[model samples]
Target: MKLSPRMQFLVRNGLKGFLWLTVLLAAYFLFREVVITHKPDAWVERFYARPMIIYLIYCFSEFFFGLIPPELFMIWAINKGDTWHYLFNLSLFAGISYLMGYINFLIGGFFYKNETFTNLKRRLLKDSASQVKKYGIFLIIVAALTPLPWSGVSLLVGSAGYPSKRFLKYALFRLLRFAVYGYIVYQTHQI
Candidate 1:
């Protein structure tokens, strides 16, 4: 059976996400084995020492187009090797990321008519805007689950006047992404 265009898109992006995850985990293993072996405790200590700073950076990244991948944070939590604490931190990270996306959506709606924002939307979302319009909330699901810029897509959806209720419903998949990735990272760390 032939897959529909949407299904093809989803399959292609899903494979990309899986590939990216594999590369990330491999890099993490190389770094941990080669570099961190010398001072493992020291590195983990520093991460634990400045919890607020790390969280703040994560918040900023999530709000500003996901500058850093969330998997890195999951790796950090895995380094600590406290399952319950890691789960708690993962939840917090997902919450903060979700909140940031919502904030960006609100900002996009409130400033949709502003010249500066219009220019930004044009420049930053040149391709994404068209995709979002074509795919509707399916694109939102893609962004939430894959490596796409979640905040940018959220902003575009809001500026395009998509309903808030539907957006919220679709965006809940973001949490599932976190949970799945967190579990994978945790399991990978075991190896």
Candidate 2:
């Protein structure tokens, strides 16, 4: 009558999944009812229609600073409805994110040249580069897939002088993260 350890873990996870599914269904029904009773405003349509504005905001937010959470944009894409438009927006966001990571990689090289910090924290500087060389790529993918600061990971890889071609090849894993997140957000919100 007792479950094995693996079975226990599976049962616990199944229960969690059931709970989440129930909540999501309830939310979906509520969302449908609200949409039926109250239409979205005209400005809402206008804003979503303008892809350029959204792309600009995404680029600036991602590149200059990781200021805005990308989920907001994903949700926006879901609300936009047309499949092509949503896909376009999501792809644009992912591309910009990748480019920003590359830029951060280059910016990291600057730390090596900055004599002020090097003088103050020689050991710290040397150790960081060594650590990156040792474990940067795996850590980079993990950071990209999660909510962690992927920009910092990119910088570390660059600082370690990891080859640009290798970084590009491996860092494409970020696209997978985008695809998975986009699917979940879109599915949950879609009618």
- Sum up the clashes in candidate 2: 0
List TM-scores for all candidates, in order. 0.82, 0.69
| Model 1 weakest 10-residue run by lDDT | 128-137
Question: Which sections of candidate 1 miss by over 4 Å?
Answer: 115-130
Residue pairs with colliding backbones in model 1 are none
Tens digit of per-residue lDDT, candidate 1, span 1-191: 99987778777877786787678668878987898898978887877678888899999999999988898888877776588989999999999989999988887777776788779878887776566566756777888998788898898788865678888999999999999989888887874
Report how far off residue 80 is in candidate 2 (Å): 1.9
- lDDT of prediction 2: 0.71
Model 2, residue pairs in steric clash? none
lDDT of each: 0.83, 0.71
